[model samples]
Structure formats: C-alpha cells, structure tokens
Target: MSERENEDRKIPASDPVIRLTRYAQVPILAGLSVAMVLFLVTFFVDIYDAIQSFEFLDRKKTILLILNLLDMVFIANLVIMVATNTYNTFRLKALVQGDDYIQQGEKAYRRMKHRIVSTIIIISSIHVLSELLEFSQTTPLQVAALLGFHLVLLATYVVTNVFKSSD
Candidate 1:
C-alpha cells in the first residue's frame, strides 16, 4: 500500500483535536435532550389548556389545538432523531468498526434526512391548516404564500427521493 494510504487508515483517537471534538459533542447531545423534554412539557401543557377551556366543544378550535399538538410532536421527534443519530455516529464509531458499521451509518444518515424532511413538511402543513382554520384573520395572499411554500417543500422531498432511488 502507498504511504499516504497507510497514514489515512491510522486512527486519530489519541489526537487532542479529535478528543476535543468528541468531548464537544457531549454538551450538544445534552442540550438536545433538554430541548426534547421541553417540547414534551409544552405538549402536555397545551393539552391541559385545551381541556380546561373545553375547546373540544368548538370543532374549529379543537382542530387547531390538535394540529398544534401534532406540530410539536413532529418537532420533538425530529430533535430526538437528530440527538440519537449524532450520538450513534460519534460515540459508537470507536466501539464498532467494520463494513457493517459503515453500511449502517450510511443507512441511518439517509433515513434521518428523509424523516427530517417529512417532519418539516408535516409541521408546515399543520401551520397552513391552522391558518386556514382562522381564515377570517388570514389574508388570501398569506394563505397563497403558505400553500406555495408547502408545495415547494413537498416537491423538493419528492424530487430528492426520486434521485436517491435512481442512484
């Protein structure tokens, strides 16, 4: 093998720079966990408020509240996915090494990207729905713009998946 290739294969786990980066990821993971908890708390608070106000009697208000809760769920799931994947990529790499690790990592990456996009689309749709529910307060232009943005996101997801499948 070439000298450069041999050097490239050497593990940098002992390197200070590598160690620092790995350590840095700890706080990031912690912050993500905190954020996920906060989202959960917010979700339950919304549910309690809805119950207290007897929003279920009003179909429109109930639907809006449900949509808001769904949006929070999607967002929390996104945050959890990111945190888990980040932990697996960084922390698991040193413990697991092989073709399987590389393959699994790649698959996880693709799935993560797909799910993130899907979550964003769902959240945006919820926002659009909530706005539509309050049509009296929403202008035609605002509705049109929101709808256009949602379509763009949906189209982008479809086109990316098409290309990914082709590959």
Candidate 2:
C-alpha cells in the first residue's frame, strides 16, 4: 500500500454542488410539496363534472379521462421528484451504499443519473398526455411541434444523465 493512502481524507465544504444543495433542498422540497398538494386537488376536479354529467358538459367523458391522466402524471412526477432529489441532495452516501443494486458506489453518480432520467421521463409523459387533451382541436402542425419539443427534452435528459444504452 502507498504511504499517501494513509493520510486522512476530507471533502471540502467548498464543493459547489454539496454546499448549494445543503441550503437549497429545504425550499425546493417545500415548494414541490405544495405543488403536489395542488396536483392532488386537480385529481378531484371532476366531481362537479360527474354530478352535472352530459346535461351540462358536451364532452365531459373526455375531460374526465384527461384529468385522470394528468393526475397520474402529477403523482408520478411528485414521487420521483421527492425520491431522487432527496437522495441526491441529502442521503447521497446512504442511498449509494445501502442499495444492493448500486454496486458499492463504484459508479457513484450512475444511480443519481438514472433517477434523474426517470424523473424527466415521467414529466415528459405528463406533458404529452395533458397536451393531447387540451390541444384536442390543434392543427397537425402544432401537435407535431409539441411532440418535437417533448422528444428533444427526452433525448437531452437521457443523453446527458444516463450512459448510452447502445454502448
């Protein structure tokens, strides 16, 4: 063993990612948690539509379905957001070391990257599903444009965070 390996090791408080996250996690989680509450409210939005039914609404069925899909997206996004962000910002080493799937943190960032990618996927799925319903009368060109944006976001998030699957 090398003599240098015997020295005490310390991670500096100057690391920008660590320092920023220490202070930022609370506000970020608080805001996201509130957003989750709003999303939960959206889930129950269809009660009035349900009571009135076809008498008042022309396409109440379609609206209800879309709202349900939106609710699922929001819930999924919230779960991923809370899970991944908490793991990355606070319980980083514990997350990495405690998971059997983590391979001893050899690829320390891999777990984080994968979680981030999954979060992006959930968010993009929500956006697409919501757009499909609200933009029901949209032109083909507009739908295509929105789809292109989703694809770009998906690709960028995947490419940047995750190791190439093809590789």
Candidate 3:
C-alpha cells in the first residue's frame, strides 16, 4: 500500500463522522455509570434494611432479600460490562492501530454478548426464586409466566453459544 493509504488506515478517527460517532458514546457511557452507581446504592440500602429488620431472622424473608440483592448486583454488573465495552470499542481503536483493534473489538463484542445473556438468565432465575418463596401471594399464572420467560432466556443463551461454537 502507498504511504498515504497506510496512514489513512491507521487513523480511522481522522474522519469527522467517525470522530463524531465515537464522541457520541461519551454520553452513553456516562449514563451507564450513573445507573451502575444507583444500582449499587440500592443494593446497599437493601442490605441495611435487612440488617435493621427483625424479619431477617425469618427464613423466607431473608432468602427473598438476598435474592433481591443478587438481582441488583447482576444488573449493576451488566451496566458495567456495557460501559466498559463501549469505551474500549470507541476509544481503544483511536489509540491502537492495525489488525489488533479489529480483533480486540470483535472479541470484546462476543464476550459482552455472552456476559449480558448470562446475567439476564441469572436475574430471571433470582426473580423466579423470589416469587416462589412468596408462593402464597403469587398467582399460579404469574409463576408460570416467570418460568416461561426464564426458559426463553435460557434457550436464547444456549442458541447463541451453539452458534458461537459453530463459528
């Protein structure tokens, strides 16, 4: 390749459109960070509530509270995963050149997808468990719906992993 061509390939952010799109991700990353913090705060507050309540001694109530906290953690982790991947995708390319950027971006994307699906499955399972703990208050239809949703998520995760392995 010509020297100019090589330089052009190395600096994709030189294009105004690419630069603008990358900069646009800044706000999204910021929003994700804020959401993660909120989730963390809520997680801690739930812990505090559990500690302060005599209901914590009750097996069902304690189990439910723990499941709720787990749900919050999974959500916070999802937010962190997205934000980190987004920043690395947009910012890292500008800092690194050549095939390394392409490979890293592709790998990061696949990893993010898997993590997101897995986290969703975990959150769904927690929800189902929590509902089951309060079975008296939960209608049979509600439980069935939650189970169906969890199964769908599980199926999706399996299909995605199958395709990924095939690739």
Q: Which scores higher on TM-score, 1 or 3? A: 3
Better of 2 and 3 by lDDT: 3
Tens-place lDDT digits, model 1, residues 1-167: 99987666654336778668977999999988888888888889999988998987899888888889888888888888888889888966777555656787888888889899998999999999899989999999999999999999999999998666542
Worst 10 residues of 1 by lDDT: 6-15
Candidates' C-alpha lDDT = 0.85, 0.60, 0.85
Using TM-score, give the best candidate's number. 3
> How far does residue 133 in candidate 1 sit from its true spot (Å)?
1.4
Q: Model 2, stretches more than 4 Å misplaced?
A: 1-7, 10-21, 51-60, 63-79, 82-84, 93-109, 115-136, 154-167
Ranking by TM-score: 3, 1, 2
> What lDDT score goes with residue 112 in model 1?
88
Per-residue lDDT tens digits for candidate 2, residues 1-167, read: 55655332322224677557666776877777777778666666665555556533547556646656565675656565555656554555433323432454435455556665666666666666666776766777877887888888788876765656632
Alpha-carbon RMSD, each predicted model: 3.2, 5.6, 2.1
Error of 3 at 37 (Å): 2.3
Model 3 score (lDDT):
0.85
